[model samples]
Target: MGNQLHASAIRWLSHVPFPTTLVWLPETVGADEEALLLAAPFLGESPDGLSLCRDPLGKPYPARRGYPVPWLHISNTHDGGQRLLLAAKHENLVGVGLDVVHLPRLRSPHKDRAYLHRLAARFMEPTEYERFQCAARQDDEEALRRRVAAHFSLMEAASKALGTGLKVGAFMGHSASLPLSALGALQLEPSVQLFFDDHAQTRLATLNAQRWEAYWGSDDTYLVSAVFLFDNEQINKLPLDEQTPFMSY
Candidate 1:
């Protein structure tokens, strides 16, 4: 079941409208081990030359021989050390973030109907919760559960893409707030765009400006969400000077 779900996630992720690659690694694996895994013939031959590193904000990026690989962007998420969800894109993409959660795990063993709603409160704003309530009222118990799962994955995915992992200020800040308010309105259909607010645009102006979009899907077991920070004008082009021959999903 776990292998099937993992394959399903990779297959679903391949359809994302960007040049991206994804792989799964053990959650507790170190950078050297991760580099070696990625260095398999499918990716490249330079095992010793590949590794991972973090920036000042702790965003991981692909590196080579201890030096940052300028053309690779990477982001990762996991569900409590069960497995690592690693996503990579070329420098042509500003950023890429991914998150996955197990849906069955969300159901409280005690059968608490309001479990999802209550859990959302920890991260959702008041207005967001209000909108969720309005939409959730029309959903059956199962649908309501999926919506709540999507809620968690989408928000966390977007936060990771922004290089801030669920920080309070990333969702609602004085200078630049993500368009988190837009998420509340989503029906969690198949995929949707989560626009950034004016503050975000102004702040990201230097990266030739960007727009955020999230794509999500689920199986009976796992829900996966991916966030991309891409150029608004070109969508898949970045200002990097070099490129890497990384494999894609």
Candidate 2:
């Protein structure tokens, strides 16, 4: 149903020992029935007992599963023909959030001028700008550009996971300063592990964050990043791709 890396990623994620199912969906046309598709993978033979419910704000919660899943939270996002679905069991984890964009969507006339500088100033910390400055000085201008895109994408996805979306919650630039190397790594691999900067974890109290990265599928023209809360307080438990779940699938 998916590429080897994607299928492997889901299996790796599902083994987080948190009683969650990470399902991958194929790109489809028009509006997709996201809620239905979230449970479609695990429905197996007995699809009758699985139920999907919504809260006051129309947030989805998986009430029961025909299999053993008791409580589930799903975050669905579709952009530029790419679809990402994230689910976490409510009892083991608080919630899940996701954000993704077509990298080309960032294409704008305001490449790097007063307007772009103004927006960057509003969102990024002064220290963050220093990192960007260092990158810009390099001969690899493409890496510098991709770093900006990857870092901003991480900010957006992290905010969504905090249940704040963009307007009020998209201000990570003020408090968070991710490693430039990590940001660069994301442009090539989606499995990189990223821990929050010192300010974010202790000073800002903004989000309990870790391990958000980018992906470029064989047929995909877009980049992707996702963020999620952990079951326990071990935020930096292990390198994301190497963290073996304490519980079995």
Candidate 3:
């Protein structure tokens, strides 16, 4: 994993407007080690010199010399088995969100297509769900499962960016009564829109007036998703032309 990024990941990360990094590893890395070890490069600290502290909402940020670095943000998720995903970005007004879904579990006998359809219904708009169901009916079970899982991953990732978990308010809906679909219309950065990679399933949107960049990708084992939120200040702080390529992990 020495600085090499998956081709799909490279294409997906290239569209981000700021220096963001993602790390995927075995869950055995140790819970605390997830951030401390992987975050050292971005935080300018050796793993031994870094620690973690959480905000009131329980979001973790790295601490250096025993002082918390509030401006930098980190997030992590475990696959419920043997994998972990972490994301980090060092901007004063930014946050990162991540989620991992085990695809094989979704196909378990008890968690079949109908079960997934029911889960999707809880979050998707009625019309969106109808369309998904219609398409799923004609598609193979695995395709349907992956598409539904992608939508879930994107929403969960957005919630993490918002620091609200999966609450109703994170829906980004027109109203509390109606929420937008995960694949619904969104205001994306022009560069992101032009270079969109279907393989990575990237998406960008605005939530509570903050800029949210959401992305997802998968292998046979699991689907990983991440989001980066640039608060209003960070959003306006940099001009598009001045933004640089993503940082190395």
Candidate 4:
């Protein structure tokens, strides 16, 4: 609706270390379908990139481009269904991957453990599970959220970078052990580091995966995740302004 509302959303994602902003289009002001259409523009194409195809099921297939580096796409909707979509890019080949989830949609507490287990089992080792179980027993919601978000966000970012969807199922095959502190720690593939930050009621994580860094942000209301790609020289040349949080979206 107004700049104030947009500013609030950007503040929610202040943990990201990039110059990020959200754009609201007239058509997407209150429609989910229109919001999805806006995603096409960020892909460097028109809204109707792909023709709707039928596998005999009348299913619609929209043509989408694979992100070559780290980048993030995020959408925020209000009670009336109005939405705002954001596309953020990093200067390096290392880009960002982002995801947002409405907290109310998460399963009930009794079922949350099971859900977390199933998702974690797909990517975590036995010891990691044990630690997560302990955290759950202690009712450590923050710790649990960080663990889950870190695991899945990294998986998604890796998938985007490789131009392969979750079809590879690497997330289900690999294992990760994440710590419970705000600075959650995970021993990932060589040269990779994972950092967790909680702010404004959100949990944000950063993964230095290969030559890129992937970040995940979530809160009681939504989850925002992203991936950033960068090379050694570019990383060193990153403008200082990119790190300064802006007051506008």
Candidate 5:
């Protein structure tokens, strides 16, 4: 497969060629299982591939037949909390990761500082921390919320691309910066890159590096998903248009 990114929700596909495909689901779409069932056929896999299910806590559920490709699953958070799921095929050598969260409308009180700080320390880069600090100093609630959302989302994307789920602890080690360029320089494990766009209603982040690409989208209904090719080097050798085995599918 070749390395590229596509907007699954767009009417016109991008010209960039890559072996990977990104599927974005609206709030109306079902959870991971349902989304996978709909997406499997497009990748030339059977509906049974969606049978395997796992909870956000990483507990494995039943699957009809194990998938032959890597998959990253994401869903939005409700009033309680959110869930992220991942699955992959060892035989075919593919891996996937995913994450999701609801965008915060208001900043929490200082009483919630401990929790937020811990999360920031875990997933934010130094530049991101600076930006957050600056936003906090100005008492800009909206800016703070957006930065936090962007930081977490990017980390989530990186985690998925690395195929570590959240098992790895480096996520909290990074932060967001004022100038977006600072983001490209952060040294993250798995050598991932973070991309984001934040507005009043939504915050989206994606990580693309080498043969892998991971993404996170948060709003009233948020989601994250990632796709990775088995042979990392093979993707670079092929042209973008001719990239994945699924092109014909």
Candidate 6:
């Protein structure tokens, strides 16, 4: 977790712009091959297959094992034994975060309303709790649960991208008395949209929807939420498949 950075990640930085991109792979006990395949599309020409190294912060960066990249910001989450790998690189950008959750499981006994309600009370503001109740009241219980789960996932990503993951922020000021680390504690006032200049930059994207079918290959039962923090002039939202050469900054 010391700030000393790796070199390969730095190689991606140059005077020209490099779009911020992300990839997700199921977790593996050994090396994660699925992530490597996705990376091939982005690395262009003879990539040594996407080696990774972790910094003192335990952040993974695509680089030779020991040298950490200074520009790449990474965050990941685990769901049902599956691992998600998210990496974002921008010229002097702040941070990036990613989260994934399975949708169909909302109907599972484990995620009953009582559990969700308790979790909401611990981390949500009163308004947030009320909103959840309203959402949960819908006859389409599964869809409602999915929406709530997606919202929570996005907030988690945003919290990580902000480098506060669950802490008091200047935006929250005094109203958020406790560190907003838990889902219920988040004061998602004016809204999560305000954090981004555009909609796609941060999204509660549908996983089993047609819009993303091309990107993911087919409809799957899940939702992905990501938060990207960058200076507009410094980077553009990366498309699903893109390749940029490394150059000097």
Best by lDDT: 1
- Scored against the true structure, residue 194 in model 2 reaches a CA lDDT of 38
Q: Considering every candidate listed, which one attains the maximal TM-score?
A: 1
Order of the predicted models by TM-score, top scorer first:
1, 3, 6, 2, 4, 5
Task: Give one digit per residue, the lDDT tens place, for model 2 in 62-115.
Answer: 555433345455666766655666655434344465555565654566664444
Which residue runs does candidate 5 get wrong by more than 4 Å?
Answer: 1-30, 48-50, 53-93, 105-119, 122-140, 167-211, 214-230, 233-249
TM for every model, in the order presented, reads 0.73, 0.56, 0.67, 0.49, 0.46, 0.56
Q: Report clash pairs, candidate 1.
A: none
Those runs of model 4 whose alpha carbons end farther than 4 Å from true positions after fitting are 1-18, 23-86, 89-91, 123-146, 168-210, 233-249
Q: For model 1, how does the per-residue alpha-carbon lDDT over 1-249 read when each residue is reduced to its tens digit?
A: 124445654455545554454555546656334633563333333546666677666667767777866545667666734455344444456766778887778776664557767766755657667667887888887778878877778777766666645335444533333444423224455456454445445535645535666777766777777777766555554333222223221
Which stretches of model 6 miss by more than 4 angstroms? Answer: 1-22, 31-50, 109-115, 130-139, 163-220, 231-249
* lDDT tens readout by residue for model 4, 4-57: 443432444455455444444433333434544544444443655422221122
Which digits, one per residue and each the tens of the lDDT, describe model 5 over residues 1-249?
122122231111232243333333333434545544544554345765456455443423335556323433222222224222333332222434444445443355652545565666555556656555554564344444544554565555444433333433444322221222222213222333443224200211222222444433333333233333343434433364652221110
**Candidate 6 at residue 122, lDDT?**
60
lDDT of 3 by residue, 5-74 (tens): 4335334554556555555555664654563566466435467766777656566667777787655667
- RMSD in Å for candidate 3, one decimal? 7.8
Model 6 lDDT at residue 180: 42
Question: What total of clashing residue pairs does each candidate reach?
Answer: 0, 1, 0, 23, 18, 12
- Candidate 3 clashes between residue pairs 3 or more apart in a chain or in different chains: none
